[model samples]
Target: MSYAANFERMGRGFDLAHAIAEADRCLLCHDAPCSKGCPAETDPGAFIRKLRFKNITGAIRTIKTNNILGGACGVLCPTPRLCEKECSARFQSLARPQGADRPIQIGKIQRFLIEHSWEQGSEVFDKPEPRPAKIAVVGSGPAGLSCAAELARDGYQVTVFEARPEPGGVLRYGVVSYRFDLQFLRREMEDIQALGVNFQCNSAIQGKESAERLLKNGYGAVFLAPGLWAAATLKPTPEDIEGLFSSVVYLAALRDGRLAEMARRIQGRTVAVIGGGSVAMDCIESAVKLGARDVYLIYRRSYRQMPAEPDERIEAQEAGVHFLLLNQPVDYVTTDHNRLQGVKLVRTRLGEPDDSGRRRPEPIAGSTWVLEADVVIEAIGNRAPEESPEWYPHVKVNGQKLIQADPASGKTSAAGIFAGGDIVRGPALVVQAVQDGKVAARAIKAYLDQ
Candidate 1:
């Protein structure tokens, strides 16, 4: 089945009655734990209360006021592990006789409100007076959108430049449709645009010359929010294989609804996915949906050490993807014609804790295994664009090639040049990017005011 067919089967939008019923369960706590749990401080209690009161518009406004990407967040945020996990209602339930862990369905309620607003064509925000300074925001992802929206609300003219044809960066291209629908993302983009943030699509900034041009074009400040787009270096392997791909390319194809092309590459094949993060889950699930007969996710560490959410791992398993933990691929084996036939994997064991606190993987001696698979998809990780530093040399960088900036202010080494999102933090959750944008916006406003 095609990607669209898959979603059609999954269904879209929530039932309003069910949503309100869930929303009504909220105790409307004065000191909302859900809000405290949220990195962006989204008031779940307030929004739920509004939804319970049948004030859909008010609920959306409440959410979008804090998170410009609120709609997408409603769909993709791991609320069950974040906000919902800490909900007072759940705690109250735990204290009852027939103790049930029941958190008010905050994310679903937020989605309902957002969907309602979309149906009614309700605007996200009202236009404000224009400020004197023009702010240039690079990359139209969540961080750039958030920064642009916040600055526009503060009455600064903001122009968001995107390298892709669409305004949303990763949200539009990198995320799978099952996680976040493109229509909702487009609506959010529209709302941002309504706030007076202009989008310039298909514009890539790769070097200092472009930076100088943007600076010369009357932009008082520049915020580089270009997310990590570069795929990590793959071990030298035979690409003459029938199906060898990167998770980013695979997910992008799925998002663009090119399922036939994607399926042609993996259908009826035994697939091996490298890495164990959300993207790996995406790859495994995509393989399942695209008709891959056998899908194996080979990670270098134990299941407990996986970076992906537990729920995601469960979902991938439910979809019939096999997990081969504590194994790392050493090389891809190929036939004489260079067609991929299998992989040579080395057994791994947990070593001492690394600097990141996770136990590092140590290769086990003489534990080599050869796994047969027609396809191998690498989802290890992503890095910043190679030319980023060359393009903007003034931008500070950490060891990981992530843009170095003050988390509190989003200011880079260069004056009037700030940055945020994955580029700054190195492959973080979307909520973090939104928070970074909010911080950068405030900092830009303060800087321009002087």
Candidate 2:
């Protein structure tokens, strides 16, 4: 299969007629459970109601004002577990069982409205008066972008610093363009830029002294949102071997325009990806698209315990990626030259529930095997920055190595500093990160005002 065929977005949201029809399906609830269920507080009920009344400008305004990344969230967030599930119209309009598209398709409708407003070239935001307070936001991911937009709307001078060569953080390089096109992400960043948020790419805040220096240089407050780009690697027997790739680096290669080279090597090869998250599914499916002879996803637990969104699983299955369940990899079966040949594995059985509330997989003794594979990608998960404490000693971290901050306010133990996004919440949905940024922006405003 060509990459172009796989690059197609799942859907192009909704058309004008379909959007209006879906909006009409909304019950216009007095209490707005759909809005309440949104992590970013985007107020889907109000926006859909406005859209239903043919108030396109009002609908887009409601979404963008509440959640800066409304467009991205509209496409990416798992509505089945979030806002759409809470819709009052689901029971009546959707006759399916167990979250089978029974809702009004709130997300698709929101995307349509936003895209329509943009296409019409209607001005949706009024420029705010400039304020003297300068705020430094680190990491140009969804959280930092959201915080910057909110602060700019409040008339604060906001500058977002990105460590990489370009901004957008995970949105720019971590995700596959098949699901999230870079052109769309660029348009959203242009919107943020219009809000007076300056982005300084290739600016790395090295240590605590550098951060303190920003405050000394008249920056009122610093918001840390450096996302979790560090991948948790597998400990192969003695040491790291060849043909091993982490999902972060693997997905990044595609987004960074290096997939052609990777595809050349992976063509007609056997590939295996380890984990049960969205990244794992993406790797496994991408291997298939890249022309791998055999692509397998090795998950220790059952399909029901997969942490990935339901759609990802379906997509992988449709793409013909094989699933190796109830199996745990013990070590790499390598050749004398140390190149990966296959993976030694062990069968597992469900034991007790682990900390994640999912049944743990216990290896069944004497049940060992080997799966042939030329390449392996590990997508187990990511870790919060381990150097965070060195960067800011006062910032506390929990047992999971994630930065600890007040849940509601996003304030850290350090004065004049706040944190959010993946750094604070670990790997989470974009909508949740946007919420963290919004909350932190509000708290920063309060601190500055006082």
Candidate 3:
């Protein structure tokens, strides 16, 4: 099968009838626990109520008012971990017999509304008159876009500067195609632009005087949301080999139209992926769809201990990925020409819980073994946050390199400078980043008002 056909989306959005039915399932509690559970505060309960009454425009506005990328989050948000988990219907379902409990499909309803809004060419936000004070947002990721969109709707001149040629930061580059296609992404980008938010691609913000420089120039306030682009690997990694790539490189190649050729060259060859996070899951699926003879996910811990979402792990399993659990990669053997030939691994046993609350994988001595592989992809996680900008020297970051901003508001130690997203909270869900941006937008507008 062709790569695109192989990676066809395994999930579908709700149709109009399905969405209304799902919306009708909402308990419509006055307290609305689901909305309280939402990080972006999109108020799923309120939107569902509107949809139940057949007010689709109201539902769409409710979402767009809160989240700029409502459609994207509808598809990407881990609702089971967030809103759906707190669903009152699901909670009350415990009183019934087994196989009778299901949360209101808020995410799918949200996605349907967004697509519907596009078809009607409805105005999500009226274009506002430009204010005297302009805003500069670095990094056009979810956080930056949300911040920009919010500020633009409030009459501020918002210009987003992206280092990459295209916007959508991780959403455009790192996200898997099977789940989110670029067409939807482009539509969202256009919607943000409709709000009068300008995007300057290929304009990078240097670490030196990043925020201060913008403020001193024409910009009145600055918000930093540069995502963590650096991909991490094992501490003592093998020398650079030709057949090895980092998760960032591997995933970017998939979206850039280069993976098709790479897949053809590596067809029928063994591919090994390391780590146990969402990126690793994406790599495994891409490799499988790419037609690798064997795609092995080499995670050091047991399946139960994987950092990737439970649902994600199940999907990877369904995609025919071989799970080499309880195996820790020790080193890689390369051919005479420096191409990766195989990976050496040692058996691992679960030990005491570590900082992340998962049982640490302890390598067993005298149990090393080698597995032949033509390609190796490292998706362990991310490195420390990228270098801090000289503009905010007072900004403090935790040991993990995450910016120490107020959780309630994305305020930093530096005055007139706000921060959010992966830089503030490390790698997280798109909804969290959206919330971070929303929070920062409020604080930034408040700061500028002062």
Please give each candidate's TM-score: 0.95, 0.95, 0.95
Return the candidate ranking by lDDT, descending. Answer: 2, 3, 1
Ranking by TM-score: 3, 2, 1
Q: Pick the candidate with the highest lDDT.
A: 2
Per-residue lDDT of 1-450 in model 2, one digit per residue for the tens? 476566644447789999998888778999999999999999998999999999888999999999988888988889988998898877773565655546789889978877786788767788788999999998999999999999999889999989988888788888777778887888788889988899899998867667657777889999989888878876833336678888888888888778787888688999999999987987887788889999999999999999888889998999888899999988888888888989899999999999989899999999999999989999999886566567776778787668899989999988889999999988988999999999999999999999
Q: Tens-digit lDDT track for model 3 on 1-450?
A: 577765544356888999998988888889998998888999999899999999899999999998989999899888988898888898766799986978888888889999889889998777687787889998999999999989989889898989888999888888877888887898889999888888999998877676667877888778888888877766454437878888888888777777676687567999999999888998888888788899999999998888899988999889888899999998888888888898999999999999989888999989999999999999988754456545466677777777789977898887777899998888888999998998999998888888
- Please estimate how well model 2 matches the true structure, expressed as its whole-model Cα lDDT: 0.86
List pairs with backbone clashes in candidate 2: none
The alpha-carbon lDDT assigned to residue 302 of candidate 1 equals: 90
Compute the lDDT for candidate 1: 0.84
The 10 consecutive residues of candidate 2 with the worst lDDT sum are 93-102
What residue runs in model 2 are displaced by over 4 Å at the alpha carbon?
8-10, 93-101, 236-240
| Model 2: number of backbone collisions | 0
The local lDDT score (0 to 100) that residue 260 gets in candidate 3 is 70
Q: Which lDDT value does model 2 have at 257?
A: 71
Better of 1 and 3 by lDDT: 3
